[model samples]
Target: MSSAVIDLKNCDNCPIRHRAVCARCEPDELEQLEDIKFYRTYDAGQPIMWAGDQMEFVASVVTGIATLSQTMEDGRTQMVGLLLPSDFIGRPGRVRASYDVTAVSEVTICCFRRKPFETMMVTTPHIGQRLLEMTLDELDAAREWMLILGRKTAREKIASLLAIIARREASLHLGKTGDGFAFDLPLTREAMADYLGLTLETVSRQISALKRDGVIALEGKRRVIVPDFDALIDETGDDADGGLLS
Candidate 1:
């Protein structure tokens, strides 16, 4: 997921100014965006869009988490993506929803109506280019995920997931890691199982194994603390500097 633009009261002071689609936009271009953009929020468990539904807006997550998932014919739901703060939502050119998007936590999103945004895209080459960059970033993240899923064993997969989220969160905040850090697992065990393609029992068991091995500590059920970040990386069988390798 793409990180969010920092908007401290309005677009003018947005921190993500250099990374968002508007990164290269001029003052006038920003002003035009300020005119068309608005914010919408969803409560946890709320549906942002059902697959096959008509979607009217594309947005950026300002806060919280969203899940992109699809239900199979037998009603098995599988998670395909996790959207974190600053991640883009909606396809710029698509008119129909491609998957069911749900707010896994309370979510606030900065929204742009699709038609207007598309019109702006035509007039602004920078927006087009920044979008390409974001798409490429997504591809890089996906490749990393595929490696985790395809080759890693269940314990390794869970460790890799924890490592990736920790690294990504640090990159979003301080842009680097220190000795260690802590974060809550945003997804429930069931959700994690769906994403990892594991049974819920297996997910819980591997987590317990990691905690038992001293790779991670569980403050409670969801909170995780890594005493040594490199040790956690060691559990993943990756080089010490990774968790974002693609």
Candidate 2:
């Protein structure tokens, strides 16, 4: 399929624009991004970069979903990160990818040549500061996932993943209803299993159990409706009185 065209004019309205590379940049700095940024698209299931492959650019998701995964010698794989629209991908300083990046859905990315981007970041303090902030947020998310993998129960892991996805989707204005909302589950059972450190059978079983308990309603295999956000979080094994961010 042909790649989707990215509208540069929409950059100002992007949810992450202020929180990402352009956050601290002057109008002139944004003009530089317009000059060097280009669009690339990947089909569903396509590998954007392989582990240890040389990456020539850094990118941010313009549309659709992607995943970062690492595999062991024996073929056991773990999903380390999920990328959504406006989420940055690839590394500024790294030449070789540490994990395999794959498009979980048809995806469009805003790309910049690494050399120019690196130089621009150095010359632009705003962009550099924004990138540092984003990196720190990603690091925190990675540590949260580590806790999930190391400590949470199967049901709690599944709940935590669903809660995270729902919160992000809602933040992106993809919610279907009020605070109680519905959205498609972007990952497959096997993908969920990889992310949550469970067997596919276990993932399937837990999803079914959640449906049975009325914590979530399923319109189909991929569609989910959460009627009570707090209840879903309760299933995640977080402190009952704590807030979502806690």
- The C-alpha RMSD in Å for every predicted model, in order, reads 4.3, 2.9
lDDT at 150 for candidate 1? Answer: 81
The model with the greatest lDDT is 2
Among the numbered candidates, top TM-score falls to 2
Please give the lDDT score at residue 48 for candidate 1.
83
- Cα distance off (Å), candidate 1, residue 19: 4.6
Candidate 1 C-alpha lDDT tens digits along 80-165: 78988767778888999899999999887777889999998899889888888888988898787787778889988898889878
TM-score of 1: 0.88
Q: Which residue segments of model 2 deviate by more than 4 Å?
A: 1-19, 174-180, 241-246
Candidate 2, which ten residues in sequence have the lowest lDDT sum? 9-18
lDDT of 1 at 111: 78
Q: In lDDT terms, how accurate is model 1?
A: 0.80
Clashing pairs in 2: none
lDDT of 1 at 229: 84
